[model samples]
Target: MILFCPPGVYRAQSDTELLAGRLARHAAGRDVLDLGTGTGALALAAWREGAASVTAVDLSRRCVAATRLNCLLHGAPARVHRGDLFEPVATRRFGMIVANPPYVPSETSVLPRHTPGRSWDAGPDGRAVLDRVCDGAADHLEPGGVVLIVHSQVCGPEATVERLERTGLTADVVERARIPFGPVMRSRANLLERRGLIEPGDRLEELVVVEGRRG
Candidate 1:
């Protein structure tokens, strides 16, 4: 699908595609929610997979506009909202929730307040957004609903699974991909190494998709 991604909106990458592929399997004929729906890629993918409806939420206004434009361009039935994760849809629940949130560990504990970095930086442990998603997923999901979240293994996939399980959902790592370091990860390789998150010579990072299902 052709999408208009302006300067500030995140371009769809491997993590996005991986999560979208997973979405296609379960989103068909269901109500879907795409959190941090940059460029509306996953939301559009869900729509194409026959989702009854799709709602996309992003913290950036530019992303919200970009998603809205892409939905309009593709004639996809997706509603775009600009707010923090799960905030805009406080009173709503969905059959499925998908997200490719910021999971790149940064040097600081605080999240970025600007563009680009805000799309990928998730504090020192890279769990700032991932943890929030995992913590709140159960409350936002309908009975038998599932939440799919993609993040780097460096950010602790086990922690995510444990968190989701603690929320009363059965969770597991459903997909994984080993990709060479991108600009962000490459830039932080030394830091990650010092922090023991990665080996001294490691250059590739494993991205994992964690799926949580409510009983």
Candidate 2:
């Protein structure tokens, strides 16, 4: 599949592919909502998986444009919206919601709004965006709906499960993959080590998929 990622939009990465793999069997006949639909990669995946309908949301205007073009190019029927997480779809609910959000721990508490850092910086603990995904997902989900979110272990996958559970959803880690450090992770290896998020000289990180179901 071909996707166009604008200059400032985030391109699909390993985690995107990982989460997308689970969509094949689950998305068919379901109305899907893709949060943080960078490049519309996951949105297209859901469409390809036979989703009944697809709606995508992104915080970056560039990403929204990128997703729109990619979906249009592929003839994937998806409604692309620009707004913060869950903001664009406040009055809507879906059968399935998927996200591959920023979970990289960064040096600063404030997130980048204009720089390339906007694509991956997730504040000090990397939950700045992750928490919102977990916290607000339940309210936006239909009865017995599923939300699948992927992120690195550095941000605490267990916490995602717990947070989702607190919202009256049954949540658990559904997928796990050990991948070597990417460019961002490699660059921040030292800081991660110093912060004890990673052991000395450890350059590998595990990405986990947390599946939450509203009951």
Give one digit per residue, the lDDT tens place, for model 2 in 122-214: 999999999999999999999979999999999998899999999999999999999999999999999899999999999999999999998
Give the distance in Å from residue 125's predicted Cα in candidate 1 to where it truly belongs.
Answer: 0.6
> What TM-score against the true fold does each predicted structure earn?
0.98, 0.98
Best candidate according to lDDT: 1
| Candidate 2 local Cα displacement, residue 80, angstroms | 0.4
- Model 1 Cα lDDT, one tens digit per residue, 136-186: 999999999999999999999999999999999999999999999999899
Error of 2 at 122 (Å): 0.5
Clashes of 2: 0
Number of backbone collisions per candidate, in order?
0, 0
Which ranges in model 2 have alpha carbons more than 4 Å from their true place? none
